[model samples]
Target: MFSESMGRITGLVPSRFLTLLAHLVIVVTIFWTRDINVQASLPPDFTSEEYEEEDLNVLPASTEVILVIAVFVLKKKSF
Candidate 1:
């Protein structure tokens, strides 16, 4: 009874083992040779400095809006 059960399960072990081996070989071969890119890219440089002469003025250069007109009209100076 034991032999009959074992034979039914693994009767043709050679063909089954050969099929599994072939599939493993195919997977390993496919993973071995594939697309491989090992290069890098670089960035560009773009900068200019031509308005350095007018860097000093009586008015403040940090602010862009015209607050002098609104503030002077609403209130007067403390001094």
Candidate 2:
């Protein structure tokens, strides 16, 4: 179920790309055409946060640990 949810969130490659592109277009259109700012429109009841761009990165130590575990798992004999 967890894996399925992840797949749904990530979507199928090509479909995800198009969905993202459509979202980008809508955002750009709203920002460019309307004088209204997207950030300022948030509900006052909830704390609003500005969108910040970020690059995804995984820790090397974690990757190394995962790789080591994977190697051991794959090394098990008997099919």
Candidate 3:
């Protein structure tokens, strides 16, 4: 019984690792392409100075908080 339980727990490791890796890659990709995203979202006439003044960090920070809460809720339910 103990071995069976351990086996089930161990089976989750690879999937969890891959999930973590995928999330990291996605976060990195979003940050890497952020400038392009900002330009696309703003008016074409927007100046560099205006872009420099934009508060772009808020969305990512809130998204991270939401993701963490969601993961915790899902983990609690799964166990």
Point to the candidate with the largest lDDT: 3
Encode model 2's per-residue lDDT on 1-79: one tens digit a residue: 1257444333365575577566555645553533234334434443323322111122333455555556547866531
Cα lDDT for residue 27, candidate 1: 44
Put down candidate 3 lDDT per residue, 14-73, tens digits, no spaces: 677688767766776766677777777779899887786553543664477568657756
Best by TM-score: 3
lDDT of 1 by residue, 1-79 (tens): 1257445445455676577566555544433332111011112332222122222221242231234334436656432
Write down the lDDT that model 2 would get: 0.44
TM-score of each: 0.32, 0.31, 0.56
Output the better candidate (2/3) by lDDT: 3
Whole-model alpha-carbon lDDT for candidate 3: 0.66
lDDT of 2 at 23: 58
Alpha-carbon runs more than 4 Å astray in model 1: 1-11, 36-79
Better of 1 and 3 by lDDT: 3
Q: After superposition, how far is residue 58 of candidate 1 from its true place, in Å?
A: 66
